[model samples]
Target: MADIKPYTIAIDEERLNDLKTRLSLAKFPDELDEAGWDMGSPLADVKRFVKYWQESYDWRKAEAELNSVPHFVTDIQCDGFEPLAIHFIHVRSKVKGAIPLLFMHGWPGHFQEVLKVLKPLTEDGDGVNYPAFDIVAPSLPNFGFSEGPKKRGFASEQYAETMNKLMLKLGYKEYVTQGGDWGCHISRALAHLYPQYCKATHLNFNSANPPSYFTNPILALQHAILPYTSREQRGVGRSKWFDEQGRGYNSEQCTKPQTLGYALADSPVALLAWIYEKLHDWTDSYPWTEEEVCTWISIYWFSTAGPAASVRIYYETTQNVDGRKNKLDHQGLRAWSPGVKLGFSHFPMDIQVQPSTWVRTLGNVVFEKEHESGGHFATWERPDDIITDVREMFGKGGGAFGVVKDATGYAS
Candidate 1:
């Protein structure tokens, strides 16, 4: 039997009532007099969301809107973990020679991040000079509509395995990828583990250490002689700020997720504040409407694995099982994969934006661009920018042109 089947977003009425009931009975804590965002989510902002979530927010309308996209689910069996019903959106370009592109989303973000780029990436390229793509954006195992793995230790390698297998099952022998946040790490893991199939990768976030004298003599020389650009300096400050004060969520999620998961799973308010804080802090000054904010949280609130399962990835990826951390699991995830071509775009507001040279340390650098403005959620906030970079990288005479050989990424 074919494991892949079409999916529709239909939440049960009882779950909807449960969410409203919980939101109604939520007990909120007091905030300091002038505490803005310096303290986590402001009491007022959350209270507003709670009111909207309970009274004004219509999940059925949101579900109908999401159903407009093409979604499918299939069983992906990882080595250690059981077979999971993975959810994905596969939009095939009409162009016969279109390239297959797998887009991945990270924490606090779901496959919906790929929604904005879908029409442009798959439709707008017709008769245009740029190449078109057969897009596959999957909600990773345990996130969105995908079923979660019940076993422990399903880290990046397992994620890579599931994604790679998903593409292969769809008959894509080779493909390219684009992402930020955990998408960056998971795509990097794919390039590392399955370099044979992942021909090239384009990333908005670059998480890598500086070149070393012993291992990267030439890059180290450049690092020693050249001063960081003004933008790089600011980026360093942003990263430092994150390391110091902004990354409390990471610690809790990575070390003791279950303890935190109880609150996330049980309380609608806890889940709202937990994800809402990231949406606010991770983006540039992009004005977020109430609908946008609630739509995002509601997905998690009604995810297949429940809201709690998503955070376990932090623990699985970080905690060393038996003190044996796989290359795709830890710091080694950002390491270079020899056969894959690379493209990098630097946006100022991303939490860990690195210098162009530093990003080059990660792989065979082919394409690079610096956007005037953008942030971690580049796919949504800067959709055109992300799509332009991909077209430039794989377009005619572009650096990665014909990397997948017959897949020209263009219509004849």
Candidate 2:
């Protein structure tokens, strides 16, 4: 096991100046008459953001705030692959016997997603009868301060291996997990591959396909016979709209991420527009401040790995999308993994939100919550709800109570 080292966020002056230069020289595109979201992110919105990013947003101040958070790094190696220097924020609870919790972030997200829950999840609860956790939220390879692979074929399996090994290296022989988007996919992979160590999981995004008769006859039948809930019906519509109108990025990234990477890497405007669209569309009408948006994008601009490295996971995972050969069977990750307790939070505005029957088929569901609002970035947008779902699933009388042996994370 590699020795763990302290880590901090600091972008040099040259890079900061280059970002400003790029922002100043960015070209503005034409917009259609009153073209709103349907035409992708609006030109007007992009212009407003670019002006703020160049003139008003303070990158130095944002850096100090992010640096205020404690971070650490250690090398994790998977068999056959090279070792990777993984970056993470490790916050321990004041309460002894705190449950070890692994938090993972997905695309268009980084370790920053943990900011909202870092305190509540790790602090000793005041009078509230709930368990505290020792939280480990990593910047998955290529996404944040972490390093990325130059070689190809580092898919979900590799990601799971990286996270699982990190926990073991940190002396967490057993742990639970929480995630959304790619976080959901990676946690599912962890539960499937390392059920012995990863005891349970709570996820926010919809990740499973409808159960099939071959594998899940009972669930498949129930899926066929039962009437969809009003929420489920609305979810179907939301999913359909995303499929038709919002999946352009998915197709492009899955096939030609390298080509797209240039635009993201070289042009600040391009990168901002690309990610800003999702931030707007994927949320539940949450008002985003100018500084918040800039800081979010700035992480990518000044990431340890260049902005381009962040998008390669898309291409690597879906290289066989053309069906020439086998691709990463993402659907396989969603299949039931026994001995692993499962929990899910259904955020109404999340991309690809699924019906209960579909999500329930994912695994041994111990708890679930269907929220009236929230979206893909649920950890940031609805931290309390996500933490509560996890707490309820692992607390006393909860389905996964006493799962981690002597570590129940409660006051004696």
Candidate 3:
């Protein structure tokens, strides 16, 4: 195995300057007199983001902040398969005998989302509190700093296997896994393929169950009746609706990501508007003063990872769905993990899916929770509540057992 090394930011100042010049020269599409985001990112919003990126956004500062975390890159030999190299940040806990935990991120999101939780998890001596655990946040292969996969057939299942290799390379015998969106699917696969290593799995979204079961009469009746009767169920349904409306980006990414990638990959402002729009729509309805949303966009814009990251969804989903039916078959699922145990921390302001029916059919759900506050970006939106839930779920006397392991015959 090749030794892993610390990665340094090496972006070219000239390239950044070129990006600004292109943005300044862009010829935008025409819109109606009262045009707005109903079509997509409004011209005004894109202009604001471009101005900020050109005049105010500091790539070096953001790079320094990201570098503050301890990060490493390692190469793994996958037997006969091509070698896969992985990049990850390890945040150590001040608490003695801390457990190891692996956190994953989904599409349109990255390792930055978890930094809020990472701070409290790794530090001590302040009011911050959490179960002591070594935290590992990796840029999913082909996403951020992680090297792009060498093979063409890379999917969520492949991502799971790669992550499993990553854990084994790091000498973790067992660990807990948590994720949302694509991360949720990959974590579920990790649990299914390597149950011995995956002591427990937790998810934010619970969409892993087979589609056939969703149409089953009993489940259908439960889905229909439950929403009317249960407040949580109703919230889940509403959340689903909101997600569908806000998910235009997903549809585009899953289908024609490469076409759109040309623009996003080249222009920082374009990438900012593309990602920032989702952050605004999905986060808690609280008014995000302009600075806050731009701050998040600045991270991705400066990283120069916007297009590479977006195309991953196209690669994964296109491999799974093709141009055929929406329903996923068992064989198709076997390519990924089958299902996962789910947990929820419902914030009063954020809409969430109910755990009862969702988890029982999905996987072995060992924990379900309801918190007073927080939203989609739990770590960033409400770090304390997220910390509390994570502690309660994975701590001693917690809902699940042992740490997660890898299925590819690798160490935990």
Candidate 4:
């Protein structure tokens, strides 16, 4: 606890003036009259947001709202990498045996995603019927207020190390995880690498390959025997659409993040458009206000490591750097991670909406739920969906019940 200290959101006055100057002098690009969202974030929407952001948005109000939550910062030094200052939100339930839950966020999303569900998750629950959790949501390295690793080859392994160590530092010897996007990847890596410490996981983004006969024979047999349900067929179509059309950002970030970083770092409009596009496209049409958009973009604009630092996670994990490949590859994450209890929540409009059969192949899937609606950012879009699933999964009679040693997630 000596190494961890209380944290607050404090963007400098100079930075606020700088952002205003950039917005005032921003340039706009010509758009196709009827393009809509087919090409990218519409020019009209961008211009409107720009005008609102420059004139009416209040950073001080937004900053105060964010600081209302309990936050802390600590130094975490991964093997062979310099110590980086990690920022996290920590909320401890009054319930003595409440489960420890580590909530992670992915690219284009910050630790703020936990805000909606924070109260419900950490509140006291009935001893025998409902459950409570001690929530720890951290801004991953190179994201939000957290410092980024300066050295190369800091991939999934380093991330898992950072998260695992964070939990251990908090005295959570055993815990479960919930995440989407890069959070999904990092949580899977935690299960794969530190099964003893990470007892279970509940993921919203179910990105996995089909079960192969050689690897998962039971799942493979089921995959072959079952007919594709209409929902699964639609999900597959969605997956294909993402692969063929929605992955231009992936390609660019994985190959040349530095080149793109220039645009994102220099121009506030460019950063807004780049992230705002995903916020629009990835959600289940969640109604977004201009103030909400500005606050979301402002976190990245005024991040400790800067907006440009975040994208390197994609490049570092996918491509070999400094003559060393990532310790935990993406394909390895898709494979079965034994001994770790697994749960998944499938949202129809998610970026890669895979079949339940495909997701089950990843681990010992003790629980699964399919939602009628929701998208990539389930935490923000449908907090109730995640809250229900987590309570059901770890509550009494659930498959993963009591997975975390004596932590039954209820009052003593």
Measured by lDDT, the strongest candidate is 4
Q: Which ranges of candidate 3 are over 4 A from the true structure? A: 77-84, 124-130, 208-230, 286-295, 298-306, 318-342, 347-355, 371-373, 401-412
Per-residue lDDT for 48-117 in model 2, tens only?
9999999999998998888787889888887667888889988878876688899999889999999899
After the best TM-score superposition of candidate 1, give how far the Cα of residue 363 lies from its true spot, in angstroms: 0.8
Winner on lDDT (1 vs 4)? 4
Tens-digit lDDT track for model 4 on 1-412? 6778999989999999999999999999998779888699999999999999999999999999999999999999999999999999998888766889999999999999999999998885864568889999999999999999999889998999999998888888899999999999999999888999999999999879998889888888998999887768889888888898799999999999999999999999999999999999888889999989999999999999999999999998888743553457788778789999999998988999888889988889999988889999999999999999999999999988888885533211
- lDDT per residue for candidate 3 within 23-124, as digits (tens), equals 677666666788865566777877766677667766677677778878777775543456755667876666655666788987667777778888766564
Taking all chains together, each candidate's TM-score versus the true structure is 0.96, 0.95, 0.82, 0.97
Question: Which parts of model 1 are misplaced by more than 4 Å?
Answer: 126-128, 321-325, 406-412
lDDT assessment of candidate 3: 0.62
lDDT of 2 at 67: 79
Tell me how candidate 1 scores on lDDT.
0.87
Model 3 pairs in collision: 172-412, 175-403, 175-404, 189-337, 197-404, 197-405, 198-404, 198-405, 199-403, 199-404
Clashing pairs in 4: none
Candidate 2 off by > 4 Å: 126-129, 320-328, 406-412
Q: Rank the candidates by TM-score, best first.
A: 4, 1, 2, 3
Number of colliding residue pairs in each model: 1, 0, 10, 0
